[model samples]
Target: MKNEKCGGAATPRWFGYALQSLVYLAHHAENDVRCPSGEIATKVCTEATLMRRILARLARANIVEAREGRDGGYFLRKPPETITLAEVYRALEMTEPLCTGLMDTASDGMIGMEIKGAFSGIMKETEQLMMTLLEKRTVADLVKEVYEVKK
Candidate 1:
């Protein structure tokens, strides 16, 4: 998926899509059913291609599994409660730093350069805090938060 820049940072659109797809999978996991990419995409308000790309990443991360043929699709590789949000975030393997554009502008002068360095450190700390919080939560937690008492 093309990285869409927003407010000087590339908005993590893929992350949001991945979370939606994962929660859907979690809800359906009770039946042990493999859901089609198209069905998940429809449910998540995204395109099948995008869903496939995101799921491919998740598959590599071992968060989900995929199959082929007439009745093939994707399913969770583990229980929702076992899949942490941090794992999901890391699965996307996002390359763009969240302060991309802002950093670019930081090349203006001496103060800009110093501020850029400071910003870089701040970003790193922020990410660490984010991961720590995410590590404490799982897909099941999110599913519960969204659906409340899962069906």
Candidate 2:
């Protein structure tokens, strides 16, 4: 669960599902191993419908490709090494960050404005740091980490 929220409204779980789907695909990335949504959903423990939506977003980002018809399925359009965690975040449209943004958006006068302004600055800085770190990590890097843990 990569996109776990700390507070505020809960984040859509699509990002985690998308990452897991990418990681799953990365392991079988070579030679264009296309797999159906059912199979991927089964492996990732998510609904097929949600997986389809997530995969559609990834495909739109050129991270994955989809084929139609009976033999149709999904395959990585780009190599795992070229796919960064930041790319996944971007693909999922996670521009608004989680955590840091406290207080409701009720606009409680001058004090509220000042508080929100400060929180906005902090949120931006925090999100920037997160993206910087994520940009350094790729799907291949994560796959390697998983293998290491398994060993």
Candidate 3:
């Protein structure tokens, strides 16, 4: 597949782009400032149109608020500390994880079916663990991480 705008290999390129843009905004959201999509595009290195689409989805999720006219732009709907990475993941991802095929029962025989069941169970538990971590982290946490890294 073609590389996504933000250089991530996620099935849909926009997922990574959206998260990167949000991180950028979270870091730069000083004074409750609203920034235009084009400004965000330049900072995050994506096309302005893609930023608009991503911002629109975030707006619908109430992760960000969109404004209109000359002074119009996008701003976080809530404080960065209040928005979990899991919330953004839900807004950007529209499908189950790519391992869903493992969830299907194998018609080959009892062994194949049993193996599929075992694999599916493991995958399900792993996914839940990942979700738990994401739910525990927020945009503000990510910003704090960057500051810590710089030290």
Error of 3 at 67 (Å): 1.0
Model 2 C-alpha RMSD vs. true structure (Å) is 4.9
The global C-alpha lDDT for each of the candidates, from Candidate 1 onward, is 0.83, 0.78, 0.75
Of the two candidates 1 and 3, the one with more favorable lDDT, higher being better, is 1
Residue pairs that clash (backbone atoms under 3 angstroms), model 3 = none
By TM-score, the best candidate is 1
User: Which regions of candidate 1 fall more than 4 Å away from where they truly are?
Assistant: 1-11, 97-111, 149-151
| TM accuracy, model 3 | 0.73
For 50-83, candidate 2 gives per-residue lDDT tens digits of 6787788888899999998888889889889999
Residue 49, candidate 2: Cα error in Å is: 1.1
List, in order, the clash count of every candidate structure: 0, 0, 0
**What lDDT tens digits, residue by residue, belong to model 1 across residues 31-104?**
88899999998898877777788888899999999999887889999999999988988888877644466667
lDDT by residue for model 3 over 1-151, one digit each (tens)? 2324532222345656677778778776886777899998887777787678778878889999888898888888778899898888788664556355566545368787668767877878977987899899888887788666898
Error of 3 at 22 (Å): 1.7
